[model samples]
Target: MLKASSDAEALRSFLMGYQNTSLTYQTYLKELERLVLWCAHVQKISISDITSDDITAYQQFLMLPEPKALWCGNKRSKRLKSGEVNPDWRPFASELSPTSIKKTMSILDSFFNYLVQTQYLKGNPLSVNKRRKKRTQPQTIERWLEKTEINTVLEALSEMTEPQADAFSIIRAKYIIHTLFYTGLRLSELTNHRMGDFTLIEGAWYLKVIGKGEKPRNIVVVDEYLDALTEFRKAIDCPGLPAFNEKMPLIPMQDKLNPIKQRRIDQILKWTFEAGARRYETLANQEIEEGPKHLRRASKLRKASAHWLRHSYGTYLVKSGCPIEKVKTLMGHSDISTTMIYVHIATNDLLDSAQGLSLQEED
Candidate 1:
């Protein structure tokens, strides 16, 4: 067996040889780090020495990782230098859905295959058919927000009063939530937007977003959210409308002029929903008495983040009788089938509890 660091270095070198993009590289690097740590700590061997039995133990560990407190932490990367491994970071943030489990295992198989072809190891322990658990097609809840909860959250954002020092962060969070809800842009699309992306088309305003495959999509700016956008810009001392061809980040860090990372958006919404959850619980207890009736819906909102706004936008369109094809185009779905799910969400509320015919956790 090779030394742990040495084996990790070799695995990274192999993964890097593929010349993956930055996101791809980071993902593979983390998975390889997990395998290396498990080999060293649990199996008492190096990555190159792990067997099929070790793999099973690792799978079980992912299901119910003991010492949950240690396994969880802020999702930010603590170690940034390329090829450096952080063994302390847990591979699975929570229980892996069958879909995630299969993907992780498949990546390990690919890693071992690369090693075998390069003659770094005699055989691949993961090469044998381990029979990955079958996963079914997931139901498309799409993570929507109820209209009442949406209005409640928006009102909550409007009512927030904070100190001068914290004003920018609070205002920025409100703008992000409002813009996402109104435009139905994915979090990636929204974060990538530049100030110059906004334009006045003929009589109406529009915002250009780089969608799923780097395709540019123009979304119409609704009147209300555009007002919100204007207010946000003014608060930052920018013009009511952004300057022509401005280069500053859309949602900069605090007062710094750098675009907030994708993860930062989720972090902001986590607290936003947490606050909204409290308000939601207060409202529910006032109007209803049942323990489970509205709590289930409110609980889901509490767990939701920015993505829920996008889903709510789609569901709203579906409920408004927009043509399925139109919704597909607006949501940037290449396949119509992806858009069709929103229709089910709108029309099949009563049957949803028993829909999909198979049990599968959302990815």
Candidate 2:
């Protein structure tokens, strides 16, 4: 609470110890900021005094969303630029989805665990009960592209006419779309990429990424993806292979030398999805109109996001006889259970015994 600086210092020191990616730090900071604000304003207790009951209330706030007055302030000032202190910030914009709730809770769990390890707090209050609710259970099979959908998207990208005025942007979008599908990198990892992140090891191409939890991972890609990357770089007048020691942005901004932000990447993916969706609609015409309102009615590229391509990557790998554990390592999942979900993809080989072997006595 505002009454003392000791708890604040403890939290600050704890966050200072974090070596995770910037996005992770931002997310954790925001989550803890919400906790501190709630504790100070509503519970009238210090952070050190928070209980399971408080955590339960916080869960409710995440599910129902805080009142507009509580979390609907102006955007954080970029001029200030201090990660720890944001003068105008709101923790919640809307109700958290089940997945979101779990994500937030996971961050908080790590926070309290850190506090406990540092001997700053007695115990973690949010480790039990509320998070165990069925609402947060991960679905067995999440959304991913079918083989037909994948081909449709490729065809659409291939059909892009040359000599367009926005040639650079078009080619860049094609490369990014393919990379996302091939690498299965999270949006943050993709945006955080640098020119030095790529390497040619043993005549194979690999991309080094700082993924979640500040873990470094190497993603191996085939020659086609590497070829596309080289083509894009050469189009922009860069070296065929990115320099290992260079600090230049991997996916550079047109005007600035810096890398583009996640929002811009999201825009690119959205455009790609819509384009592919339109192509699929044309290829498989139906009665329904092809627009946002009726877009969900179609399968394939309908309502897909960049992450769907990632899921498709995992799904494709698992369906193609890759072991779940191997996929887990490649995908950079700390928990194999998270990777196991890919095992249940619709395309998994079905045993013949599952089909009826019954022979009728009198047909």
What TM-score would every model get versus the actual structure? Answer: 0.71, 0.77
Say which candidate scores most in TM-score. 2
Per-residue lDDT of candidate 2, residues 228-248 (tens digit): 888888887878778876677
lDDT at residue 256 of model 1 (Cα atoms): 41
Worst 10 residues of 2 by lDDT: 291-300
Clash tally, candidates in order: 0, 0
Off by over 4 Å in 2: 1-4, 19-23, 37-46, 66-94, 117-119, 128-139, 150-165, 280-303, 346-363
In candidate 1, position 24 carries an lDDT of 46
Per-residue lDDT over 1-363 for candidate 1, one digit per residue giving the tens place of the 0 to 100 score: 423257767776777654534444556777787777667666689887777777778777767665676565556555556756565555555665443566678778888887777777888877654555456575567468888777766666666777422778778888888888888987777777788888887878888776764666788788888899899988888788876777777677765478998878888887777667767777678877753655666687777867679888888888888888888878887778767768766556667766776777877
